[model samples]
Target: MESNENILEVENLKINFKTYAGTVKAIRDVSFNLKKGETLAIVGESGSGKTVTTRSIMGLLANNAVVEGGTVMFHDQDVLKMTEKQLQDLRGAKIAQIFQDPMTSLDPTMRIGRQIAEPLMVHKGMSKAKAMAQALDMMKLVGITNAENRINDYPHQFSGGMRQRIVIAIALINYPEILIADEPTTALDVTIQAQILDLMRELQNKISTSIIFITHDLGVVAGMADRVAVMYAGKIVEYGTVDEIFYNPKHPYTWGLLSSMPTLETNGDELPSIPGTPPDLLDPPTGDAFAPRNSYALKIDTEKEPPFFKVSDTHYAATWLLHPDAPKVTPPVQIVARQKQFAEMQKKLAAEKLSHPVEEEEERQ
Candidate 1:
């Protein structure tokens, strides 16, 4: 549990896109809080508004988009209400965004070092010499080899993983307090994905910066997040600590997400995917957004929206199943089996630590 001094707070956040097709409600009443130095993962399938929600915070939406309602409060200031000058002052200074694609985010013509140092020079009034020096250090910190020499290289000179690392270096160069990473690993290979995630975690530890990690990968969420928010059709269906989400999920949508997570045991025989596609946001169903795909949907879930029912002090879920009159139902067996396996692994590690206290102490040291 983090302190009440939240680093970022989104309350009733709504984003709508006016198109010839009609107004698409990409985000509806989306609310969450990111505490200082904590990682809050926004997880969901494609078109679930995971990226859009964070984009609203960064004020990076397209021209057709409009924030219909809600407030984005950051460090005691409502960013949604801030003037363009104030927002510009905050961006790349107090906050930085890491796009999913390194190729798109990086400048092909600009030298990597200059690209990294440009934000510092523009926002922090840093001298070119000092900023370049700091940029080399940041590249090295992010695992670039011979960073001092490689600093002058262009984006094309670096490999895919290296380019991604360079992008991360630029995002962190300004030492922004809030880092928004939108599917940062989606473009990388599995091995590189692990490396990038590890680098992000290490950087977070060193800087004590808060992270808003948006990804469709449950595996990424498991490894990186302290808390999880499951979104469906522009709204959060479930929000809780990582443990609660993985072990005791209350929403059927969340259950589906956990069950569909790819595992080694799946043996490449076609990963188990969710049954139905996400609902159309432009003309969503009358009630719960997940009701169409939810196997355990009740009548109320289809006809009337379910309020977020408190499951515990820290966990809450929006589902009719949480209603007092709803029948007791257990989560799917696959999720239960996975949770058991995870618990056993934890137990084995705990026992190993107990039996080899000296090794554990030495490792900690």
Candidate 2:
């Protein structure tokens, strides 16, 4: 059951990567929250800090990376302030992540059952026999055929989709409070992708764990997410409920992302593409990073960064176009003449009423 209670809240997160070239400002003051028993989909191009943001939650950033600021509050405690021991305790037992590729996620030498059962032993201190029994049951739960016989098989024996299923089984074995699925269906075919998505939805209903779905495809997010955050240049350019983002998008980047998606009605029409590449994060842009690509760019777009303008209680976008003084009204001739006609008619009627006050009084009587 979904609730207004937030399971996790990320505020003003800033992460920088130390590179040979220079410091890369990967995440720039990004903030969003996930509601209990809901999916929050983060959509953006590659290197837009989608993966980095989730990794921060897991305390899995690289050695060279530095977290300059912000807090990831899971329930009451701040995840950022946790020690290495605390993060280790938190990772699989409370918050688990599924990587993109299933092929690389599993170990070829290890038996599939052992890998899945290992988490239970480590986290819950369950005996080997009990953990294995639980793992077998989980395998069956994830729709594995003839699970008793197949539980001992190696990771190499399973197909792409089946391996992904195993990965999910491991992630959910601990029943983590939050699941971070980093494009889990990206490698599978359309049929398999649908199956995985359906399985996730089913699991979510059963477990009621909040999910952070990271994907570049808006199509995937439409049915999956309760809310959506459209990211660009390491920042959330727009944020809203799923319906609001799809039907009433306010940001130019969101518009471009939606337009680029292939619709059923897009029969043979050329796909619309957003012009210009993303800014170099090594030296970030002064104004709006998307100004070069935004065709509706105003002078203010290049001169200053636009803050998030509230479209509704749940929807907001970072754009100067939403400003009231951004555009001036210049009424067309036809509209102006129509307004003049109405004014002249009201004046003529008033003059006649004054000239025949007795007649007006008699009519009223």
Candidate 3:
């Protein structure tokens, strides 16, 4: 059985970047923890800061980046406080990341076997021959056919799916305790995507390695993750078990996201979309950042930020709609079903002037 102990903990992690335009607040007080042997999926739209959050943990941020505050604890040591040499020792030896693009992740000039073996040779002080032997075993483990025959081939020689398997082989070469897979199957076809997901699940079970899976697809999250964290504009809006999020979501953003997902029942109906673009990070809004796009936004959402409201022991959402005095607004029909869980919450909700300034002005005019 997978232990309940936390393998990684990130608390109040705030990150920013310096550009000629201005400072971009990429991550805002983002916090989550990964339990040992658990798969935690971080889902959001593009440019929502998923990749940046993972990179910060790896200590792979760009030169212009600045961590305003927070601590990342791993094995009782603060990862943010680790020295350069210490970080070098931490990456690959204890943690490994599989980037989205396998072609760019692998070296074009080097042979496949050598690239996979390099980590073992560098981290464990193993001879090249021994590392290559282990690399061959890893190749077999990741489902590369005819490993001995293709080990010496260049990256360009393999198909996209095969290349991804090679990338996975390199990531698992050292048997690291934590794996960060950033959209590892985004570039492949549907069939190949399924294969990769299954391979990851199988490998995790065998090694008991914890995973931080980042992607925008909720479908993928359904099969891979134990917990799901929905992010919008750098903040985690709603997060809980896969069932809680898909069946009984609370936040408007979560409703929009789940409604937009194409399901088996979705055939001829028009897919719903969240109105308006995401907020500009350079000048972030003081109140709820998602209020502009959320039709369910309460007046308080525009005046002050809403803190996380407890939905259940394992579920929570950040929205003024969860406030006691807020009106009981119905979710979209498509995303509404499980009302028993929050039935008491609905009773406590009192009517309020739910309209924002524009709606009130329009009504007066």
Which number leads on lDDT?
Answer: 3
Taking the tens digit of each residue's C-alpha lDDT, what string does model 1 give over 203-232?
Answer: 999988899999989899988999999999
lDDT of 3 by residue, 1-365 (tens): 36789999999999999999999999999999999999999999998999999998899999999999999999799899999999999899889999999999999999999999999999999999999999999999999999999999999999999999999888888898899999999999999999999999999998889999999998899899999999989899889987789888999998988889887767897898989999999999878999999898778888899999999988999999999999999998777644453454454542223436566779899
Candidate 2, superposed: residue stretches over 4 Å from native: 328-365
- Candidate 2, residue 298: the lDDT equals 83
Return the lDDT, model 1, position 284.
84
Which segments of candidate 1 are over 4 A away from where they belong?
Answer: 1-4, 267-270, 342-365
Candidate 2 local lDDT, residue 271 = 79
Question: What's each prediction's TM-score?
Answer: 0.93, 0.89, 0.91
lDDT for 119 (candidate 3): 93
Pairs clashing within candidate 2 = none
TM-score (C-alpha, index-matched) for candidate 3: 0.91
Show how many residue pairs clash in every candidate, following the order shown. 0, 0, 0
What is the Cα-based lDDT of residue 81 in candidate 3?
A: 94
RMSD of each: 2.6, 12.2, 11.5
Model 3 RMSD in angstroms:
11.5
TM-score, candidate number 2: 0.89
